[model samples]
Target: MTDKYVIPREKIKQLESLLNERDIDTLLIFSREGSDPILPFLIGEDTIHLGAALFNKNGRHIMLTSKSDEKKYYESGIFSKVKTYNTSMAEVFLKELNEINPGKLALNFSLEDAIGDGLSVGLYMMLEELITKDRLQKIEVSGEEIIRELCSVKTQTEVDCLRRCIQITNDIYDEVFTKVKCGMSEKEIGDLFVEGMKKRDVINGLGKPYDYPIVCIVRAGLAHRSPGDTKTIPGDIVIMDFSVRSEGYVSDIARTAYFLKPGETEPPTDIQHAFHTAYKAITAAINEIGPGKRGYEVDAVGRKVIEDGGFPTVRHSVGHPIGRQCHDSGTALRPLKENQDNRAAERKIQLMETYAIEPTVIQDGGLPCMLVEENVVIREYGAEILSRRQEKLYLITCE
Candidate 1:
């Protein structure tokens, strides 16, 4: 547990405003403790969802939970009401819902939206049964939109948390490069990073920002290699994707380290070119950042950097906003992809939004994928880099 911080009041107010604008009475969510970003974010403390929590348009909040958790929920100070389910969970939820009797409710009902955004189907089904067909008709699958908007931008408190995490991350990398040698295994290097954070109580998000999937990798070698027991060669590259959170705010950044053979100080010609290209893409993307720039346009700026440089672009978004979790949900700057509904990138970037501008480049003939990631916040006039930008590959030279 970290120092107690105020519940993100501004963010909650923003959600309340959205409710008034959309004519929805409440935003209902269902998730266990620490699993849902919105819950911990608005509550400002780790919250346990015994069943569901409801946020009214007036900014009042109530959590429906079992009697076991009722006491704990009240202590959180985030929710104005803590109602416990006495009978079945559904009965308890129905009683609480009746108390509020919101005219219209916004929920993440669609299968994809629920899966992507997380929803408690048990509570959702309970509401369906109690609200009757007419009342259920008023429920809309706009919770994802509400969730997206509420989490898209960072508050001053949230930003401060991220800055702290980034500082810790940079310092860890500084220690890592000095101690890491050519013979170290990728897994070993990654374990060092993990241990460093663990010692400090900094928790890494095992999954993407929104819990889409958990990919914990410490990539080594220039050949799309996942961190394995394989010993690192003299010329092997180190590109690790790590997301660690401090006080529930996550910092997502990656650095490319270079390990040259004995007496070799300089990186290979091709590797240097590719590394610089990746850095250039990140810079170009930052240059394109500002209030009102669409996520896609910003993404194109970075994508063009690699493509014009005769390299293939990354498969995912160039950069996405980070907070509370890795790949944290909010806004995004992603390429326009066919078939999938990628709406975040189409919207305009806003001020106070912190994002990870990571552009990966793959050289012709499939050299190791060159990746450079930095956490940045978009300001009114420009953007500010939260994480130290990887200007040069981290070099481990045995001179």
Candidate 2:
């Protein structure tokens, strides 16, 4: 089945309306080497270098690229007008801007949010020189609102792609469990997982090859390290954190396994308790997710459970939004302070938002870490777990 999730024209219209409300007469996104993740929003494809997307309040969208990139953008069929340049396109870009005659211009650079700073320091300097001091003075640059809306709200097509990715990821987890063995090395297992995913044409969902099938915490004492040559022995706790991508949509999931010898006792009581606590925390957080809920509120449910269970909370945020990138740009579900106002955070968690809530708990002894992860979508009523296989604990027995 060819995955299809094309954003409706109306969604762009909504974005235009938002720009008007913010008094953003024009939004210009410039990136060299396609380093910015936001490029996918305007170009609809990943093959672009030294390009700029101009969006006006009147809903006019134009893409400018180097002549070498003309064929790639032309094939995408997403842009209405594709401007090509053989030499320095800055002059042509400036002329285009003058024609639009926007009162204010917004660029993706923010000190507060890294997502807003897609423009590298060097690129920003180059842009300043191209526009000159006078035109630069006319432009007002800020990052708060535009980047957030572009990434947070899922377009219908994006939501569908995410949903499918979650389903495929869950299927792979089930298949991997069947091949897991106590004597296998961590690197061997990680390799097998990658091979299996490739058979399905699902590369690392997180957009980077190094992070693909990122089976960290393969054995005890290396909870957050990358998959290595560690051997899996009896009583060893195997933790796998991985995700798969489809058409740039990402789904993240993590699972743990306990290897048991022929005559070994069941998993340690403390380990089981910690695992269950982490599971409870994850489930509670998912239950609390929906429209009109703050990110911190959902995060609190998970953190409190770990704390109450006599274990230290996981160091990272409870969860993050997953999208075109593994950790998409959006509000994260973390604990809130007593004096902080979370109204804006809550507003961002609208229906169709997808998040990966991986609740982890570290035991006092620090021998092992209990981790569980699932991808879910926010609906009008509640959250839905998209990942298929929900692994509480895998018991690998050696004969």
Candidate 3:
């Protein structure tokens, strides 16, 4: 089956209803060079030309774009009307806005004006001239909440794509375990990972917006000693964090492993204990996430387990969503700490959604530090762990 979202009419109808409910006349999705993820998600194409799309409460959809992506845009069958614009997007947008002239307009600008940032200065200035000050002031409001909610619910196609990416990631880690040796430099290990990826065409997704790749390539032995010329000697604490992207859908996975000398079945005792503690935290956090739990509650649950086990809590969120982007924005498993801007901390988990069940435990006394991350999709009762959970820390023994 194709990955394209075939039935978006119903979704658009819901958006139109939302506009009417809020007295919003139009919902504007603006992008320069496809900078806005919302536009692509709503339109179902990962690539797009510089363009702006307008959706009105009357169920009309309009688009402005250059020739670069016009064919793909039309073939997708998402928009009702299309206008090609060469020089000024702001002019085209303002012209359309004037025609709609709704009581209010919704733009996806959250916090420091994300939507406006992508607009050209010429377009923005021209827009300012056409719009009435009062009308602009009263009508302009952040549509981030709406966009977030719309993007949060994963369609079955997206979930299936995620599963494929996660499987590729798991396969890569297995390759790492088999080939990695005690004396290999961290960079060598990282190179091995990159090579493994080329074998499957899983190229690194770095330097691309909303693109997430196998990150933190390799952090080993106290982390300060980054993956460079530093050779990972036996008994050194090591963690390799990586991810894979397939069709714009990304998968995230991290595994901590120990290098044991020949004839050694396991690392020394303290490292083993630390690995258990981290595993405990991982399970605790994953179990806490599901349909009804608020984002903060799940973070707190993970933090508590690590702290109760005599480890300090990490500053980052315990878990983050995986989708079009690796750190896909929306609801998240965040800390209880409140801020006016933090939305993910408050939203509840939803069924059928996927998240990375990651909880980093610090083992100060050891040489082989282990960090564990697993992927899971929220199910009816609890999370369905996607990546094979590390039941015990992996051991890469000496040759």
Candidate 4:
């Protein structure tokens, strides 16, 4: 069977209905340089360096682009109606808008969601100049509901890409474990990991030249400091956090190893205890994860475990959705409860959502630091761990 991009057509229909329910007659997405990820979802192609996508409640779709990109847009086979313009394209854009004659237009700009903020402040100012203040005044603008629906639901193609991303990430972790040695510099290990990924021909959805692989975190010291020129010494807790991208989908994983010498003392009891506690917390959270549960509730499972075990809770969210972007946009699994902070109000874990269940435990006064991360898809039963190498602790013996 030919692989397909899985955004559900029904979901798109639902989004259209949502716009109508909110009294929005049309949704307008503006972009420059094809820098925005949202444009691909609406227009089906990312070639337009500067363009706008308009979706009307009447089920009509229109895309406007620069004349230079008209040929590419036509060949893309994504947009239905394409309009091209030159230096004076403002007139072309306005003319298209006049055809729609929307009573209410929705623009992708929101304080709550970053995906909706694709239109830069400068671009917004330029757009305001193109249309009269009177015309703008008549349009009602908002973002709360629009962004929520656009990103929350996963299309089949997106889910498939994410699944493949997870498998590739797991394979890379295995490769790293095999090549790791006690004396290798942190950079050497990082370089090897990147090389392994390239050998596999893994390409990110957001292709580079502009985008680069993120070394999520690399620490080799008492405090998990950034990776430096220092060689990996026996008894050091070497932590490496890395990710690989596939078709815009991202997979994140973190692993820590201990180098032990013949005479070196074993890992500190406190440090060992903290690692086990954090691992148990992660497992417990995964057990409790499933459809119909709040994201914060699952987060608390991991947080309370670390606190009760005498370690500081992790500073970041337990996990986030994986999609077109590495930190694909969606709800986060977090520890802070709704009553404790307003941010929790935004943490609602929904079904068919993919997340990274990463739990970190730090010793009192920040002693032996450790972080464990894994990707999982939220299903009816619970979270399905994507990365197969979930070691409680990796013991590396010196050669």
Top TM-score hit:
2
Backbone clashes under 3 angstroms, per model: 5, 2, 5, 8
Q: After superposition, how far is residue 196 of candidate 1 from its true place, in Å?
A: 1.6
Clashing pairs in 3: 214-243, 236-368, 237-367, 237-368, 237-369
Model 4 lDDT, residue 369, Cα: 69
Best by lDDT: 2
lDDT of 2: 0.74
Quote the lDDT for 19 in model 3.
77
Cα miss at 230, model 4 (Å)?
A: 2.1
- Residue-by-residue lDDT tens digits, candidate 2, 1-399: 432214534346656877998988888778877777566665555435688877788876777888877876666555577898877888788888878887788888776566777777777777788777678777766745677767767776777778888777777777888998777877778877787787788788654653546564433464556677768877788778888877667888888888876697678886788789888888888888888777878888888888888888778788988887778766678766578764434544777778889768765444667778888877778987777646458788876
Model 4 residue pairs with clashes:
5-157, 6-155, 6-156, 6-157, 7-155, 33-49, 205-247, 205-248
Candidate 2: residue 177 Cα off by (Å) = 1.0
Consecutive 10-residue window with the lowest summed lDDT within model 4:
209-218
Candidate 2: Cα lDDT at 284: 84
Which ranges of candidate 4 are over 4 A from the true structure? Answer: 1-23, 47-50, 203-226, 263-269, 335-345, 364-366, 389-391
Clashing pairs in 1: 152-330, 209-326, 209-327, 209-328, 222-368
- State the lDDT of candidate 1 residue by residue for 180-224, as single tens digits: 876666677776777677677766665433221111222423443
lDDT per residue, candidate 4, 1-399, as tens digits? 112223434445656787878878888777877666576665455644668777777766677887777775565454468898777669888998888888898877777677877777776777788777678668848654676656665655666777788788777777777887878776677677667777888753334522333322224243434345667766667666766777656777777667776675566686688678878888888887777777778877888888888777777777667666667667667755544654532556666677777777754432676777887776667777767746567777786
Superior by TM-score: candidate 2 or candidate 4: 2
